[model samples]
Target: MPSEEHTGKSQPPVRSQPFPLEFPGVHYFDEQEIEAVKRVLRARSPFRYYGVDLQGEAEAFEREFAAFVGAKHAVAVGSGTGALSVALAALGVGPGQEVIVPAYLWVSVVAAVVNQGAIPVLADIDDTFGLNPASVQARISSHTTGIILVHMSGAPADAPALAELARQHGLWLLEDCAQCAGGSIHGRKVGTFGDMGIFSFQMNKNMTAGEGGCVVTSDDRLAQRAEACHDLGYARDRNGRLIFDSPELCLWGKGTRLDELRAAILRVQLRKLPVVTAAMRRSKYRIRQALEAFPQVALRRIQDPDGDTGCFLITTYPDAETARRVNLALRAEGIVTYPQGISNVLMTDWGLHLYYNIPSLVHRTSIDRAGFPWNLTENRGLGGNYAKGACPAADSLFERSIVLAIPSCLTRSDEDDIIRAFEKVLREHLSS
Candidate 1:
């Protein structure tokens, strides 16, 4: 017989361990989008070179998206990078200017500033891995021309405070909506708060057009500026003829314009955004609740000053080492997990690759410097030189973080599989 102490005390057996399970290979598509693409292909009416069909479809998409985001105007572009570039150019950010950005945001946001010949002053993010207005305010100086606030991972970072900071400092605020399209803060849409808001319709985005983007703003002058900038800075007279009749002025602009086919596809997707967003919300909530039960995982809070969130989950592990281990283990189980990209603003966790990774994607003995000039050609007012350093919070969170995709088409089984996978790996790591 066991001692009284051992006999009286009892512990429950652990439930079956959950492991990350691979999701079924199912495709999610709306029939309307397919037919829309087919229609564009059949017409084949000179879709390129900015024709009437392209303009009309682009205009229609712009209107629909602007209305959806509660903005007065929207301008379509070839991609999210193009949208940010034109928006910054419209704001008159150019050489020698500086823009404050969160270090942990997507590299494209920082590149947008650098492309404008302006300097990118990296600011630290708060616990949510987003721009903290105080940190941004502290970074402002005489050369600081703009603030690019990103809603990283679809969580609405505090916009009102940042907007107020920008106003007080006389800084132009450009909202990077690439990750948080269709979201809102304090009942206002995501793209309607700042001087300019840029959205991505890249294939992976919630509102996809294969490869396209748009800029939203209430200011008509800014809208026209962006429109002309994206179209090679050309102006048309009342009859739509080039006003500068000087054939002698032989200057051309780059082609960053959205095509008609993608515009039509965007229109179809735009109509389904609300439905898709709703589904994503439901799945994210369930997965989050399940994941939160494990103390080892720190999920990003959706306290976006915008009240909505969708499709992906970003979470931080206890530290970079743990994050690395869990990510590897999850991958072995066929679960997709990885760190947030390199952050220039994250002084403590600065990873320069996030800015120039595409150009130098593979580690090679010879670096390609040919793309350097082109990479730094656009303007959104990031200029001037300053010391580089580390941001403790951004470094800790970004390096030790994991991002998971929450597809709108996920079924209950898929969601359960995700939850189980997270629980299993997290528990195993924690226990060991």
Candidate 2:
């Protein structure tokens, strides 16, 4: 646990929850979002860039989102995973090169590498539940072209260190901000820390439009490349028409354009992002503050407590068995850890989030029947292990830790109940 003055507060009374916690932005849905979508529908300009009504909501959203994250540009895409693919493509990360990604990241990260016809080398995460710079350094080789730094669980990774690491080795750094849209580090927003950053607006994210995403970057050339990659493999000319003059700019694209309906909805959600993150942060810190009395367990390490977006609270017990028993006790008291129907708190149940759990990755599934990426002459000896024990530290930590989703809609009473339940459970087990 990080050093701080222990609160030493006594346990409060536990009460039945008013409701279970849920994703942040969904709780604040109001007429603004509905009206935004209504405006788009009324305009009949569902397409972005060149709509019939030309509402320009998608372009406006990209501008606002770029300014919001302190980046020069933003490209609205079809999904978070598509943004990853676009970023990898923009950086020219394919065939014969490997991209180092955190083992504790979404499957899309690895899938993007494979889809780009590149190898993905897994790097262990540190206590921050993010990429360990030292581990990344050790994995770097001649074939390494870039590193994908994922900021997980609404907390910023050690970006400054990782950015410097990438610089020292001359590798492109792409920050995955899908889980932490509005998070920052030392007051600098997360997405601007690396060469480029990606965000998601899926149903379970901090903000939601059902499903949407964007990529942010400060580089002009890369931004153009990303725009082309998200479109039809053709860079737009100055007059805003597709141009196929240069072979460098005429690469194959994914056709991942952002529709105006989702863009209109996201414009409203983007404005409310700070509010969503702030509420969860307050609730999270208060719970962590109360739990500081328990010396027997530790909270997951954070790069900056002030910068944490605070969607989840992770506590590590001495062992996996103790963590499991404590969680069962909490649930018996009507205090759930994760939201209903979601059981990704433990790594064993964390489906595709962990590399080893992904069947395609573990089995080295081929994209084409020809088995190009893995069987290619350039990639023959480059396959890194993707078995269960490949990332021992991350696996062990997840097994011994309990994650509690902190909803932005939590009331003071809700926060008190959660703290009391943690107090009750820990007192019974750790007071020994």
lDDT of 2 at 182: 92
Angstrom error of the Cα, residue 203, model 2: value is: 1.1
**Clashes in each model (backbone N, CA, C under 3 Å)?**
21, 0
Model 2 off-target regions past 4 Å?
1-18, 237-240, 337-340
| CA lDDT, every model vs. true structure | 0.67, 0.85
lDDT of 2 by residue, 1-432 (tens): 101122123432354443454678888889999999999889888888665687888889999999999999999998999999999999998789989999889998999999988998989999999999999999999999999999988899899999999999999999999999899988899999899999999987898898999999999989989999999988876445888788879888988989999999999999999999999899999999998889888888887887899888888898888888777666555565334535225545667878888899999999788996888888877858998788888888878887777888888988887887788779887746
The CA lDDT at 141 in model 2 is 91
Find the 10 residues in a row with the least total lDDT in model 2.
1-10
In candidate 1 the C-alpha lDDT for residue 187 amounts to: 81
Which candidate should be chosen as best, given lDDT against the real structure?
A: 2
The parts of candidate 1 lying over 4 Å away from their true place are: 1-28, 46-55, 237-240, 244-254, 304-306, 337-389
